[model samples]
Target: MADTGIPHFCNDLGVTLIEVGSKEFMCIGAKPPFDHPHIFIDLGDDTEHVCPYCSTLYRYNPALAAGEAKPEECVWHDDPEARTAA
Candidate 1:
């Protein structure tokens, strides 16, 4: 929402939801300009986890397949350097 030129996973209400394929993942909070330190999280026995930095909730979806999530599905963005330069 900070216009970091990144496609965020957050909805209109500003609540971010990430569907992950694995139990362990990292959360960067948001893109640059609104980014937080990357934090590694492990779902372990749980189905979901929340990032402490941005309070983004990450859920594990079996349908995603390991390492098969699409970029848009995960809210990925272009290069940060290019976005910042603009």
Candidate 2:
């Protein structure tokens, strides 16, 4: 399910179940794996994951609304113009 296309997080707000190890959603395989404050279901495989802290799902992605440029393609760290020249 992680091979068909791009992975996305469930934008839905509410309490949801997640996998034990993978830390993803329990039922719908329609999202990515949880890595940040929000949990993510595989969306393609229906994996489940739960937060160890507040028992909330967690997920992290740096390319969701990144527009035409991806997080990996960002130049924040390399762009001297965006930084103070010391």
Candidate 3:
């Protein structure tokens, strides 16, 4: 499928593209196998999201950054709206 929008395999609810600051948004992935096989995605050791504009990697899963969900909060939430539009 073409990358016109979000992928179906991505459980919309699991992750949300929240705007942290300015034009920077976090691509939080949801559900298990957070590492989706279809796409070459990686959250990195700190599970930080790299900014496309400035390349600033901000950590997702606030808990992990604060010593919570150490395992990693790559789980993505399902977004029904996003799916319907797609």
State which candidate has the highest TM-score: 1
TM-score of structure candidate 2: 0.20
User: Model 3 Cα displacement at 43 (Å)?
Assistant: 3.2
Compared with the true structure, what per-residue lDDT tens digits does model 2 show for residues 2-78?
33323333322434532132222322222223323432344234333444434544333333332121222211122
Look at candidate 1 and give me any clashing residue pairs: none
Error of 3 at 68 (Å): 10
Better of 1 and 3 by TM-score: 1
Q: What is the TM-score of each candidate against the true structure?
A: 0.62, 0.20, 0.21
lDDT of each: 0.61, 0.32, 0.35
Candidate 1 vs candidate 2: the TM-score winner is 1
Write model 3 residue lDDT over 1-86, tens digit each, in one string: 34333322223343333222112223333333352333323444444454353233444454322222322333234556676786
Best by lDDT: 1
Model 1 misplaced regions, further than 4 Å? 1-13, 67-73, 77-85
Q: After superposition, how far is residue 77 of candidate 2 from its true place, in Å?
A: 26
| lDDT, residue 47, model 2 | 35
Off by over 4 Å in 3: 1-40, 53-57, 60-76, 81-86
